[model samples]
Target: MWGRVRKSWSTVRDAFRTERDTGRQARSHNLFEAAAAYVSACAEDDQERIEEAAGWVSPEALSFGVNELACRAVIALARERDESPRAVARDLLGLPAA
Candidate 1:
């Protein structure tokens, strides 16, 4: 799973480099937009969309955005399930409760 994410990040970085060399303007997507699209594309196993979304922001920015998304998701799920954020995250990963 991590390998796939790293490979995608590398691909995005290379694409961004090439675009920068060509003096092309970056896409209008902000960090949140890029994160949402990237995650949705990954969930759907859509490589093209993943690449496109990944190109919208720097890898670091995308990483931060994804982390933010994850935190928000966990909080929302915890609230809905009446559980702590840690419990919700562990449950999502199939870990036994503490």
Candidate 2:
């Protein structure tokens, strides 16, 4: 009797797990893709794309992804321009050099 109960519980758990996985697979884009879309949208100044990207993920996750992208971009720009990341960022923003 105990063995039967344990087997039934395992079957139920596996069924729920499969359902959750299927739902995840149905999502149009994952967090990383959303982040990339957000960065591209920002670079292009496309409000529509930005809004669409934001809707793809939780706000906190989106924010983290965007922050990571910005950090990488600043580092790349600084390397390309042979300047500090702060300087590169300021230059890009048309700010007076610090």
Clashing pairs in model 1, backbone N/Cα/C closer than 3 A: none
Question: How well does candidate 2 score on lDDT at residue 67?
Answer: 82
lDDT of 2 by residue, 1-98 (tens): 99999999987543322221354564455556778999899889999999888877767667777788888989998999899999999998999998
TM-score of 2: 0.65
Off by over 4 Å in 2: 1-25
CA-lDDT, candidates in order: 0.85, 0.77
Model 1 lDDT per residue over 1-98, tens place: 99999999998765433332236764366788889999999999999999988887788888888999999999999999999999999999999998
**Model 1 TM-score (2 dp):** 0.73
Worst 10-residue stretch by lDDT in candidate 1? 14-23
For model 1, what is the alpha-carbon lDDT of residue 40?
A: 100
Question: How big is the positional error of residue 58 in model 1, measured in Å on the Cα after superposition?
Answer: 0.2
lDDT of 2 at 5: 100
Per-candidate Cα RMSD to the true structure, in Å, reads: 9.4, 8.5
